[model samples]
Target chain A: MKGMTVIVKTITSWVKILIFLFGIYIILFGHLTPGGGFAGGVILASSYILIMLAYGRDFVEENLSLPAASRIDCLGAFSFAMIAILGLVFGGSFFVNFLFQKYLPGQPLNLVSAGTIPLSNIAIGLKVGASLFLVIVSLSICCKDFRPGTSVNKKKE
Target chain B: MIIFYCLLIFMLIAAIVAVETEKLLSSVICIGAIGFGASLMFLFLRAPDIAITQIVVEVLGLIILIRATISRDLTFITGDREFFEVVVSVVIVFVIFLAGIQVLQTLPDFGSPIFAQVADAPSNTYVSRGLGKTGAANLVTSVILDFRAYDTLGEATVLFTSIIGATVILRKKCRKKMEETTG
Candidate 1:
């Protein structure tokens, strides 16, 4: 039974890795393809769900505590907001691209040319990832009623 | 046009399933599926931003509904007037569906001057800067972070509010228990 559990976990981890990699591909190709941060983020979160299903709630809690996930979520949102505010501080309209400087080669349509687009993508990816993680974990934890020693009722001896 | 008709048919089926289902969980899932279909329709209508927002909001709403429903008694009666309600709902759905189809057929395409003006105006600054500064190939990022930063701020606030609400509601029982133990 223990070995079977291990085999199942291994398979789940592999599936999760594949999903994570696919998410990365989607984000990387977001500009050139149909997928973007929102799609990629949900896909990544589904990977985490796969692991949780295979390994159990304890495994997930051990790897990603609710507090830590919450903090990451807050930080992601704060950073995205900060980036927008930075544009305003730079004498540009809110969210205006004000910090981009011309790079070497000056080739347009190249991967290294867009000024703030990449940063925005990263910020969006972070926000989506954190939000999805928080959502899934919160839902799971709220429904975690079958865990041992979680009840307050006592039996009379 | 045929694809549009198919989508309309599917949406009608989804709505029927959502309302007529006896089980709360099934109803919730069906509603969520309808939300997904609506978002897809939004994308087809060339409203990507609205689609993304709708999808996220629907997912969050579904999660909340599921959590709330799980704790409540969801058994309800739909007495003799059930058929009337179903007929009324189908009529409402068909009316809205026909209106949507008509609107889509009549709306201006992307080549219109207003769309061109917005696409070519200062917002294009993101595209230019994105090519010149950010080294990223995605134009959406340029628009999101550079051209419309304020909207991103609002989105972040929405996320923050959602997280806070989820934590507060989910922690209530734990807080009550802690107070009882301390008292």
Candidate 2:
């Protein structure tokens, strides 16, 4: 898509960074706040959506390609499963808090205190944000009417 | 107390309007509004974490709904079968409402401490032992990621399945369009 008016593009360019940063903050500080992986992931996806709306598909593709997003999605899921398996290997349970118990220092409310929780949050945030962005991108690309000024058709030819 | 009931009434009205609306976009927006209202109700019920989750889910849901609706021509037809289906749905909804009232009457009042002493009451344990067990200040996060990791895994799996299904369903059509354009 060619995207919207210049005003929207300009404003989004400035605002999207803040939104993305806020999403990371939420994911990292999930153990201390109301927002966790899922909510932070949605926020991250929304930031990307804002960019797509303002800068169009080509811009998003250049910055974060579809294949890269898919890779990130898989990487996130793999990391989460690895964490669970680590729990089973060390603690004799599928999802036990082995790191918190055996290795990591436990301090309440600290960012580094939660052993597997924060790791899980990051993994989940990556998986959810990438997947949702992929969903929206795929759906919009499939739209029969809203092709971007014959560029895509020309490329196909 | 009165405000909570008022919110509930608003939620009911929103639901009815969402079901009755002719325009699919409008209906989806109304459902998003219902989610917003329900999040407010969750906050009033002293569950900020749930409220946040509800609002974020509402946003993603609205995005999906709008995208899905954009490509389709949505027109409503009220025929005999449609009317019959509507009546059946309404009856089922009313029956469920009555049953919910009956169940609510049998339960303890809101904020009753007796709930903490049940045999498998995780709420009390989470509140009492959660911070020490997980080194997380938020009890809900600890419960979800530490005490109940399997459920979170399942939820993640469901999300993965949905995205995969959406991709598969649309990938072929998109590829076909590209091929046709190329040829």
User: Judged by lDDT against the true structure, how good is candidate 1?
Assistant: 0.65
Q: Tell me each candidate's RMSD, in Å, in order.
A: 6.0, 4.0
lDDT of 1 by residue, A67-142 (tens): 7877777776776667667767773556655545422333445544444455555566666776777776666656
- What's the CA error at residue A32 for candidate 2, in Å? 0.9
lDDT of 1 by residue, B1-183 (tens): 565567778888988888777788888888888888888887887767557657766866686677556655544435555688879988998999999999877655644633354666564565456545444455565455555557766776787788778777655376556546744
Candidate 2 has a TM-score of 0.88
The most accurate candidate by lDDT is 2
Worst 10 residues of 2 chain A by lDDT: A144-153
Error of 1 at B33 (Å): 3.9
Judged by TM-score, which candidate is best?
Answer: 2
lDDT string, candidate 2, B1-183, tens digits: 988999999989989899777777888888988999999999998888889889887987887777667656543524344688889988998999999999988766786754444646677778888888888898888999999999999988888889888787666466677657755
The A-chain TM-scores of all the candidates are: 0.77, 0.90
Best by DockQ: 2
Q: TM-score of every model?
A: 0.69, 0.88
